[model samples]
Target chain A: MNFPELMGLAFVGLFLGLMLGSAFYYRNRPAPFVRQIPAFGRVRRAIGLAVEAGSRLHLSLGRGNLISTRSAVAFVGLSILDRIARSAAASDRPPVATSGESTLAILSQDTLHDASKFMGADYDPLRGQLTGLTPFSYAAGAASLIHDEATGASLLLGSFGSEVALITEAGDRTESLTLAGTDNLTGQAVLYATAQEPLIGEETYAGGAYMGAGGMHQASLIAQDIFRWVIILALLVGAVLKLVGVL
Target chain B: MKFPFSVAVAIGIGLITLAGYFLNIPVLQTLRMALIEWATTLAAVALLVGIANLFTIHWNKLTSGKVGGLYSAILIVSLVLTLGVVGWFGPTHTYSKWIFNNVQLPVEGSLLALLAVILVVAGVRLLRLRSSMLSIIFIITAMVILLATGPLFGISVPGLTELRSWIAQVPAMAGARGLLLGIGLGIVAAGLRVLIGSDRPYRG
Candidate 1:
């Protein structure tokens, strides 16, 4: 096999083996504890506050679509949405979900619907919205929704760019508790500046584990961590070898 | 039997796509390309559905005399007008380009420009939100980067340019690469969850 193909196969094998191994390990046993993510604590508090006050919680799914390269981030966002919807299902006003992509908006609706059903609550189709397709339009539309809906807390998660500042700023202006995370570097920087609690880098992918999506979600996170260490070790080894002029 | 048909379909398509990438088989490649085309078409249809959903929701708000009914009306009207114009003149036409340039680009640009002020405001609030050494360092780095990029009366600070380049190239690039690697692994894990039927987003 070619080098690239071999590398791809190795990655796939390692990922699948770790994932399946972890999943099986966690299936019968109790879910392993995930360390507290401070930002996620803020999200939980916001959900509780919204539930208590009868206020709406807003979730911006950002500008990621299912078919795009950002699909993984979008999926992570959806997983978080699922968790939030489950938590907020008992409230009179369920959480409002807005997405920049239509496919994600549709899936958000499904998530809410399923979560509400699981909690024995009615679902509101209007709550899941496609705010805008284009980047700036999406931000502007999401910002307007945050303002108009009078959300108690705005959770910004998914794939976003610098346009995320608009949404976070609006949340700040409205005095809503804003917890934000995105895969984009610029968006992360902007969110760090603007959001009350900002999650950096791969922390965005930790939402499912932090928010108690399921054991499977938590297991996947453990696998990711193990793989991360492996990658770091490999990098260090490569650097040392290069320093020694082994090549 | 508890597994949904949607999950099965997702796994099937995903495997085909993965095999096409790794296996280098001609038939699989052709099928993968066709599947990708189908996926694109599905996305376009979903976009239309999303637009329709937007219209319906806004229309309901307008009819219900909600607080933002006026804005909703404006949005719907603008959407209709823009779509009509594009349909009549075609997207390549000057009129379409003019509408995009005049309306869309300017609005987008204005939002981007607004980010600069927002960044400053956010930087100021960072200390208040999180009183930590890291927060202080973050603020200083941001200030340095801003100053480095800003026009400073034709004056050049010694070591400023080098510092900026080092920060961007070394630390920033390193963090970015790490994040990319983590994100890549996360994606693979999430996809594996789907493939293994442990997580069925499609079931939702």
Candidate 2:
């Protein structure tokens, strides 16, 4: 193999090691260092209410791809999805998830369908609703679904763009409870969403732990906190060095 | 645990890219370019998966015969017909560009226009739902933004242009930037968490 290929192999090794190590590390930790926040409980309550009322729990995996590590927001969104799917399964009413991306959509269908099967429901894999690839088109499809009067509680988690607000705004207009999280930088929609709705921060990845999806999610949150602090420190040092004219 | 060497290579190339960007090194740039080419090749393969998934989905939708089944069939027919025509006729063919310009563009454009109506409805109703100070602030700001953005109003008052520009540029820009920074940090953290394998939603 060439030098570039060799380097690529090493990089993948490092990434996989980091992921697996974090998973196992958190698995072994005693006393659960990650704290379960109240927001997750609220989400749980909303799902419970939807099930009781015979309404649907709407999940949108906002246009996120797992290929890039930069899509942490989407990963957090995925955690929420796991929480919601598990909750929905426990409830009498099943949940419905939607995704715009093919990969995410298929995975969501699989996850939700599996949850239903676990709950002893006749599991027919959900044929996902892929509205469109464009940000606005995806938002429009989600908005239309929410307006269908059958929608109970809507949870949107993923890497969204300016379309995040459109989805949240639609939920607001409807009577459905809405929760959205996105890491799309240029998404003017999220800014609009923040102004109007109750959104969790980047820590939505911890939603599984926060909502008590067992020790796994909690450990993930702990790992995330450590990494976040490291990033902050790095940024601070870089800024300080620039200010001091050291480089 | 065995790993996909291709995926590993793609990620390695990406990391080298980060070093290249930060350090301004020639070697890093060379490595990054090579990595990008590999990624492009992988992407082409991924696109095939996407196309196949789309075809399978539309075919299922067509067979279901429920509400919107016809629409699904229409979508499939359009997609296949367009592809078939393009395959036979080549790029510069009148049919290919015509199909894109007439069918795809209009459908996309109409969806955006509809979003405008949705936005207005959402804005107006947000005011009624909550008489809270924050809701009021949101409503007022939205109205200011809407009016300021309008061509007719902007021409009538020079200050409208300035105010609209400020709403779009200053508060809006700052909020977007802060949100973006937070998101970027979140992405990095998430990537680290994944690398650490703390949260494997993918593992089922």
Candidate 3:
């Protein structure tokens, strides 16, 4: 194999090994406590307040299609939706999930169904709504839902673009506790301005761990941290080697 | 073993797709491509299912006398009208293209244009919401870029262009690259979790 391909294989091996090892360890034992994500605490509080107020919690899964590169981020959003749905299943008003893409909307409904089943609550597929197929329409429909449904908290997560600001701003206007995150840089920047507590960069991917999805999710976060350090070390070593000019 | 038949299928297909990327095997590559095509077709079918779900939700809201039932009615009517027109004239017909260009595009453009004003409002509220050093820096950087890109009342600041380029090229680029690297690593970690049956979101 070429040097680049060899490096890629080595990195893949390292990541898989770390993830599998951590997953196995955590599954056998107890899951470790994930570092506190401030936004998660806010989300928890919002759920509590929504339950008390007999209002709804809204989740916006952005315009990420299931068959595209954005599918990974959409899955991350779905994991968070599962977490939220479980927490909100028993409330007087179940949480509502809105997605721009059709596949994600179906998955969100499935997630809600599973969460409700696990919690012994009746599942209503209507709670998982496909607000709109297009970006602007989706944002408008979601914003309207947040306003009309009396949503106490809006968690904006998924593979959003600049249109994310519309949904986040709507949440802010409605006085809902909004925690926003997306893999899109422009969306992140907009969330920084709009969202009170925004998950930046890779933090969006840690939703499953932060929300206590399972031991596997936590283990994946730990593995990611290890891989990050390895990459940093490799970069430093490469820089030093280049500086020394041993060749 | 907690791994079920579904997990095994997922892992099997995932490995084949991964191999297609790195290995010079024509069969694996073809299989990967075929699987992707299947997924795309499934996604299209899912879109139809979603449209049906949307209709049911709105129809229920309208019938049950929900607060925003009128809006739901409007949505249902609009959707039906658009679908009827498309069905009658086909998607690429002049009427359909006209509706897309004249109605849909304009509304979408308006929303995107509204984003600029919303951004400024958000920027103004940033300090009120969270008076952090980072927020302050973010506001200042945004203002600098906005001002440098436009000549305010026909007055241009000296060196502003160079300053803007430097900021965009250096600090902004570095931050973006860092975010990209983090996202790439996170995607890999998440994918491995799913492939290994460690996190079965699909099962959920």
Candidate 4:
């Protein structure tokens, strides 16, 4: 392999080792406490409020193609979906999940089904919906769905584009709470400006862990923190070396 | 041992795919390609399923005398008519192209325009929503960029253009790269969690 490939492989290996070690060790103990993130707290509160109000909750999983790396962000959305679906199992109005991708739609349906099954109920396939295929199309579809359902809150966590503003605007019109995050830079920027509670940077990926998905999710955060410092240190050292002409 | 079949399958596929990325084995490459193909096919099929679900929901809304029944009816009619027309003719046919160019394109364009307006509104509203030092800085930077994007009534201001470019290229790019690094690590750790079967997002 070339230098870049070799380096990438090494990095991946080191990450895997660190994550596995952390997950194993933390499994038997109380997982590390997650830092305070209001977006996640809003999600939990939104679920509870939607249930109590007997109003619908909208979860917009942006069109993240599963065959690609975008699926990682979409998976985080599904993880949140699983949690909310389970949490609101007994509510009259269950949460509605809208996605741009068909695969995400299916996984969302499966997530709702699993949650329903765990709660001894049947899931409505219509709840986990594929709204549209393209970016704006997805945004337009999800925006309308939000208004149509009279959603009490909107949790937009996925791989959206700048069109995320449309969904957040819908939430604004409805006066509903909006907590949004995405891996797309444009989406993140638009959401930061528009979403009621914006999750910036790595905050979007930390959703599952913050939501208490499982010990593994928490472990992933730990691994991320450690490796992040390692990268920062590497960058700093390289910068210093260059400054000193020591390369 | 009580084995979880689905978990095992997921983990196995994940491992093979992960290995394929780092290793140069012909057998692993072929397996990875096959798995990816299967995934693509499944995604396509899932699209169909998603469409069916959407149709079902609208159908239910129409028949159940819901408040939005008429809109749902119009949507269904439009959907069916478009599908029938497009299917009858090849996707590249004139009729299909006309529908896309005239209908879908315009609708998307309008939404895009609305998005621009909404973003500006949101930007202005940011101060009212949460006035902080960061918000102040964001507004100032945004105003500077917008004003400096072009000359003031065709008069180029000295240094302002350079200032805008520097802000856009330097601070913005740096912040973006920092976020990207964090996002990359997050994806890695999350993917690893799934690969190790500690996180099963697909179980349902």
**Which parts of model 4 have CA positions greater than 4 angstroms off?**
B1-3, B150-152
Flag the better candidate by TM-score, 1 or 3: 1
Give lDDT tens digits, candidate 2, residues B17-53.
6665454568887877777677567655655555666
Off by over 4 Å in 1: none
What C-alpha lDDT does candidate 4 achieve relative to the native structure?
0.86
Interface RMS deviation of candidate 1: 1.4
lDDT of 1 by residue, B1-204 (tens): 486777778889888988887887999999999999998999899999999989998999899998899999999998998999999999999999999999989988888888878888888888998879989988998888878888879999998988999999999899889988887887787777766676665553
Chain A TM-score (model 4): 0.96
- Using Cα atoms, each model's DockQ against the true complex is 0.73, 0.22, 0.72, 0.78
- Per-residue lDDT for A1-247 in model 2, tens only? 4577666555435444544566677666663555445555667788778877777788888777545653566666665666677666655546766666656666666666656665666554543455556676677667766775357778777777666666776676676777666565544343442423345445455555566655545544555566557657887899899999996
Q: TM-scores, in order shown?
A: 0.96, 0.72, 0.94, 0.96
Model 3, C-alpha of A215: deviation from truth (Å): 0.9
Please give, for residues A1-247, the per-residue lDDT of candidate 4 as tens digits. Answer: 5788788888988888877788889878987876799777777887888999999988888988888878788888888888888888899988889999888888888888889998987678889887777788778778888888899999998898999999999999999999998999988878878999999888888888888788778878888988889889999999999999999
Span of 10 residues, lowest total lDDT, candidate 2 chain A: A188-197
Model 2 chain B: worst 10 consecutive residues (lDDT sum): B195-204
Residue B79 error, candidate 2, Å: 2.4
**Model 2, residue A107: displacement in angstroms?**
3.6
- Quality class of the docking in candidate 3, CAPRI style: medium
RMSD after Cα superposition, model 3: 2.1
Question: Which is the winner by lDDT between candidate 3 and candidate 4?
Answer: 4
TM-score for predicted model 4 compared with the true structure: 0.96
